[model samples]
Target: MNSTDSRASAYTTLSRDSVHEVEIKRSRFITYLFRVESEAQAREHIAALRKTHFDARHHCSAFILGPDRMIQRSNDDGEPSGTAGIPMLEALAKRDTGHGTDLSDVLAVCVRYFGGIKLGAGGLVRAYSDSVSQALEHSTLHVRQRLRIFTLPAPHALAARWENELRAAGYQLEPSVWEAAHAVLHIGIDDTEHDAGQLAAFTAALTSGAGRLQPFDTKWVDLP
Candidate 1:
């Protein structure tokens, strides 16, 4: 696959809502939290909770996105210097990469409820980091695959045979269409170089070297 395709192959969080909570005790100090993929989603959850518990002390948040780690932002809220947001982001970075598939985006938030106890700067960092770490341990994750899109045109009569041959050769074929007297097939190929050779062979066999294969672009796709 091309560089653009490879760069996009990183895994990302599923577009769904999930919440995880943890209780931390540092001499009467308590912290409750939730993590989501996007800042907007995280903010939505925080907004509802903040409305209900308007008196809570702090709500710290962080998020990372794209295969290249393109987007990264964190907010300490109203905690001490280097206490909440930075530690929370660090915790998420140190998290097991497997939880997010190969190339995935992740976001973490730690909501703090001061129990009338000051945990100090160091204690606050540890508490915030641990909250996210614990939540990731109980969450579900997915793996993504890179797919190359190829468009091929063959004679209408040979379309079925072409698709069957390609599938039997370990290729993923999409719906075939008949345009005039030609059959157009769309295929998805993995990153493996072997797929190119396989496609060439299949095309030669199906159209007797008369058909053409064109590869368009590559993108990250959910695994079957």
Candidate 2:
């Protein structure tokens, strides 16, 4: 399903691509964590890593996608069944992805650089899951906020002023547009932040009662 399919929920995921490496029994296990919106993005990352870590013996991966986590996938990449990919997936699933997040929209990969010693099934599972858990500990996460949009009208010059001040005050904004010689600014308010009267007051303060804020649409937005 598409991201839009999960409108009532927000999720937590990596703010940026992150990686960490661990050594177990002389074997190198590198974990890659990424925020992904769709299966396409997950596949792209897996393919790129396979190329980048070409010498690595395995590129086991697991991904959870969509705000509701409607899509889940895993691959062992030639490893023995139920060891690498499933544990990696579980590692990602069990963690607290952060506030207001449902732990969706993320993909994790365990790239193994085989050492002389071989880890049996149980050892392999622990290594893969541990690799992911450790990588998440070091990762920086961002919250996805489901936002309601309001289009406010302003003069061209006032648009810039309103944009700067409101954003600095921590309001989410899309780019302002010029329409019929006036600026149309789109402000995105978090689901919990919406208050019509408060917004009306803010709009008046910005435009001196010259224009008003009107309802638009709702979508997900990331906080900085």
Candidate 3:
């Protein structure tokens, strides 16, 4: 699979950690969904769950890391090969949040409590996939975008007015920092040429060529 899709400017992930449980043929599948950023975090969560549910038959897991969703891994635990982990991984990989199937930085674990019923390979696959699907259904999703930070300095007299104007223009503004001579207004715009040009023009119009936007740092930020 491609590391990142060029279509969507942002990616989707779980809004918060969540749990959901589903039962099939008396077998219990308790799913835990965690918002993780790295392989270490994912492993830590998995280990914690294993300790918590130490008596469970299996603790199958799958995780996709990185903003690009490039790091993908899954574990079957004691379940048959490809029946548990692969399906769970596919469920997460194919999840679409209106933007596209770009879900990343999430780890899913399905703890199974065997109920004396044996689910064949197909049934096991369905059970694992359904486990994650049900958990996601109960999850709130949010978007993360790469934002370009810019600082625009304005005189004390016009700082508040410029802040209001920028907000009205739908620019994301951070709290302004007050300095001795001027107030520095921090803004976050989508890391795209279109947004950059718009912000530059707007700032120029506000300061009449006296003010310039200084590019700050770019980082991935969770959107509300």
Candidate closest to the true structure, highest TM-score: 3
Every candidate's lDDT: 0.68, 0.84, 0.91
**For each candidate, what TM-score against the reference?**
0.77, 0.77, 0.94
Residues 1-224, candidate 2: write the lDDT tens digits: 13335354467878888999999999999999998889999999999999999999999999998776778899999999999999999988888865745677899988999998989999999999999999999999887777778998777767788899778866778988889888898987755443545677777777778777888998877767
Clashing pairs for predicted structure model 1, backbone only: 10-103, 11-103, 11-104, 12-104
Which ten contiguous residues of candidate 1 have the minimum total lDDT? 26-35
Of the two candidates 1 and 3, the one with more favorable TM-score, higher being better, is 3
lDDT of 3 by residue, 1-224 (tens): 11343544578998999999998999999999999999999999999999999999999999998777889999999899999999999999998777554899999999999999999999999999999988998999998988889999899999999999999989999999999999999999988877888899989998899996899887788888
TM-score of 1: 0.77
Error of 2 at 90 (Å): 1.2
**Colliding residue pairs in candidate 3:** none
Error of 1 at 50 (Å): 3.7
What lDDT is obtained when candidate 2 is compared to the true structure?
0.84
Candidate 1 lDDT over 1-224, as tens digits, reads: 34444454445453434556555563322233343456676677667766765766776777776666667777888888788888877776666756344323666656666666677899888888877777666666555667777889877777888888888877887788779978889888876567666777777777788878888777676554
Listed per candidate, the RMSD to the true structure in angstroms reads 3.8, 4.2, 2.7
Kindly report which residue stretches of model 3 are placed more than 4 angstroms away from their true locations once superposed.
Answer: 1-9
Residue 1, model 3, lDDT: 19
Query: Stretches of candidate 2 above 4 Å error?
Result: 1-6, 154-175, 178-183, 192-213
> TM-score for model 3?
0.94
